[model samples]
Target: MPNGRDLGQDRGGDGTAASMIVTTKPPPANSPGKQKTVLLVDDQAFVRQIMWKALSATHAYKVLQAADGMAAINLMRDGGIKLEHAAGTDLMEAAAGAKIDCIVSDINMEPMNGLEFVKTIRVGMASVHRGTPVIMLTAHADKHFLSTAFALDVSGFLVKPVSGTVLVEKIERAIATPVALKSASDYATLIVPDVDTPDLYASVDAENEQSKTVRATDMAEQFSQQRPRFVAISELKVGDRLSEDLLTTEGVLVVPKGTRIAPALISALKDLSEIVKLMDRVSVVNV
Candidate 1:
């Protein structure tokens, strides 16, 4: 049986070995025999073009463009791009078995957003579409959005106005790393616990009614010790560690938890504050 590389080989018209013109065309630059595919989804034409051009310049990807999440989903379900001449055969089979390696999609779009699109593929789509790495592109940095994206098992998140080099780096990292899968139900449980669930306060509150007063006193002390201090954004100095993830009002992560402050980071935060005030204060661990 002919393998993927052996397909479309030059043959002899005369049906004789002597008449055969044996030649092998070189593979596309920077790729072996097959190029890894990337589905670029965005509602805007210019954004898609920019991503397409950037990936194309690397010569390591076969870029596919989609205007919306629905279109992108259809393309994924059908597998590889169908050629005009290959009729009556599955594109996946005809292509010698190639599938998309990564997906980069904009967060906001009409009909379906990026989060919805990812959920559909991960939960509702065929097994072939499941577990595929997805990188979300967005301008919003709201914590709620970040938490939702993380809960959905999105591979990576890139803030918008990203450069080509940064995009490529994110793509590479996403492809190389494997993310643990989680169901939407599991995510919901973690992000929003049931108010009626007894276990919600079990750790803090005593099970017996007799210990309620002691429990309250102990809880107050612990809370004071554990609670993070709110410091003025300007008062923040280098080397201070964040007690929790610093986020914009829109919920975008500014700096993640446990990050040691540096001069460059401080400067960036200052610049970011000019656009959006990071609440009037930031929470940091006392050093």
Candidate 2:
């Protein structure tokens, strides 16, 4: 501990406010390179409990949770939920406290909203947290709120009702983006949707040629690709006239019998669940 700042410094005592208790623990096993602490700020107790449960199910994170901006700021300022660093641990003295790897906050709250919270933290953060990333979790999708949030320089945005999987993916992306930017030149691994992926079919060939009664299994059995490989699928639903515009647009994924998706893909799948359901409803309607 640097200046021996106690996390429990009484707030109502003398002209100063104290922070909360340490609900979350730091990563138990530090393997040289590991993610640092994360702050979860939300007003709703139920929501916070759910978030913590999901987070705890994974890696150990030193969490300093706050119900509102004031509480959050107190924890942010007083180093951590406890007495800064635990002595000889690699954790540095609570200057700004642990390197705040990321911040997840709700948008609609009293006094200050998510946007206001972000601006405040960046403005008053200890040197370590000044550049910390913030992911705005909000229920508002209207253009007005969206515009306001973007102006605040939010690192990422997760709509309300974001699942644990999606939240984690957003966190990983925001954290990695900075490192990726440093590398400069960018490259995307293109995925040619393989029709062989079970339950997916390619109605048109790569040459935009359509075949009557195309079978998905056949398309997957034989896919031709030159580059890294991105599967091209035909958009043939039961009854709708197979439209050529599908070729002009993007493609689909042809999953194998049982393809276990990576965490990132799982996040995508969950996020697109609504779209998937809609497609399913249409699929049920025989053309």
Model 2: weakest 10-residue lDDT segment is: 180-189
Q: Candidate 1, TM-score vs. the true structure? A: 0.53
Q: Candidate 1, residues 180-276: lDDT per residue as tens digits?
A: 5655443333332121221111111123444545645654454457657779878787767666667667555545555556543454344343244
Put down candidate 2 lDDT per residue, 1-287, tens digits, no spaces. 43222233223465333344434334456534564566777766666666665665565455556665566775666663442334434433362635778788877654445555665655543334455677766653322243233334356666667688877777777665441011101011111122123122322234323322254344333332211122222222222321121111123322222122232222322333322221221111112
Off by over 4 Å in 2: 1-18, 25-32, 83-95, 124-128, 141-143, 179-287
Per-candidate TM-score against the hidden true structure: 0.53, 0.49
Which has the greatest lDDT?
A: 1
- The list of candidate 1 runs beyond 4 A from truth reads 1-34, 80-97, 124-127, 141-144, 184-287
Error of 1 at 26 (Å): 9.2
